[model samples]
Target: MKTLLIWCLPALAWAQAPAANPPGPWSGGLGVGNGLEAHATRQTGGHLLLLGRARYAWWGPKSGPGSKLFDQLNTRSRQTELAVLAGRSLPVGRCRAYAAAGLAYLLGRQLGDYRYTTRSSGLLWGDATYYYAYRRYQALGLPLEIGFQGPLGRNQQRLGLALQANFNPERSAYCVLLTLNLSSWGNRIK
Candidate 1:
């Protein structure tokens, strides 16, 4: 009985172990999706990013006049991102799933009210003030995504959906995107 058990254990382990390098060619794709996201920036009302504060704070351009004295404060900002990635794909039932990680860049801007009073030529210059809601920021981050795709029509193109996250030193952002991919996968999974 002991001899039989030992032989079967080795066989089971070998069959269940995964390969070091799976069989597939490296594939790439481009996707775009919108989700509730947040970013880190050097502006007022940009900190204390706990809870759900990050999603609602930075979005769209601020409204109102850009004057020092009668200026209106803006509590919102906007962010735009682009990423490039490469990875492999595996078949899951009738669909193919892939995971990729690479670099991403973000552009952000905000508007705010500013008031200043200074001395000019040794005289009180209370009117020496100017304001414009202008703040722009840029950041680089690592982005990872996992998604599933299937054939699109008769061509080698595929349409899929994915969930992605961007990791950086400042903050982490997430999204859910619809993806379109064209790769070397061919008709292997059909």
Candidate 2:
């Protein structure tokens, strides 16, 4: 029995040798989106969002901007964030639906104009000042995301879209993003 098993092991190893095609579980991509960020004080505004992302697998650990990274909504406001997440992915027809939750760091600032009239030399004149409606705050955040990606062609490239929400002690934000990824997910062997 040992001799027979040893003889079959060589054949099994040969059969399991590397194929012409390779599997690429790793993925990286870029994205663009729009965000609506609000403060606890009820100051809400829209921002143009930009992102960069990289990952290992849908159901495993990875790093990169899965949703958004930069927020330069207007001259009066700006924000930046980075996150680390744990997630799961599920098959949805030809697409994969994924969800992740993790910790993030948020840095944001906002400036507003404050104009008032003051009396000087018994005369009243208009005076202009600026105030931080939302003062610059850098704090920890909780980010949650849900999205899907699918093949773009016969190649490893894919197109994805996701909706993400960020919760922070100072503010919260919601974003919608579209991404393009290159992965070794579903490819034909030569």
TM-score of 1: 0.44
TM-score (all chains, Cα) for each model: 0.44, 0.55
Model 1's C-alpha root-mean-square deviation from the true structure amounts to 19.4
lDDT of 2 by residue, 49-77 (tens): 22222221111112221212332212244
Q: How many backbone clashes does candidate 1 have?
A: 1
Q: Report the lDDT tens digits of candidate 1 across residue range 98-185.
A: 6666677766665555443333463554333334455676788787767677643233345678777778654466777666554334
Query: How far does residue 22 in candidate 1 sit from its true spot (Å)?
Result: 20
Pairs of residues clashing in candidate 2: none
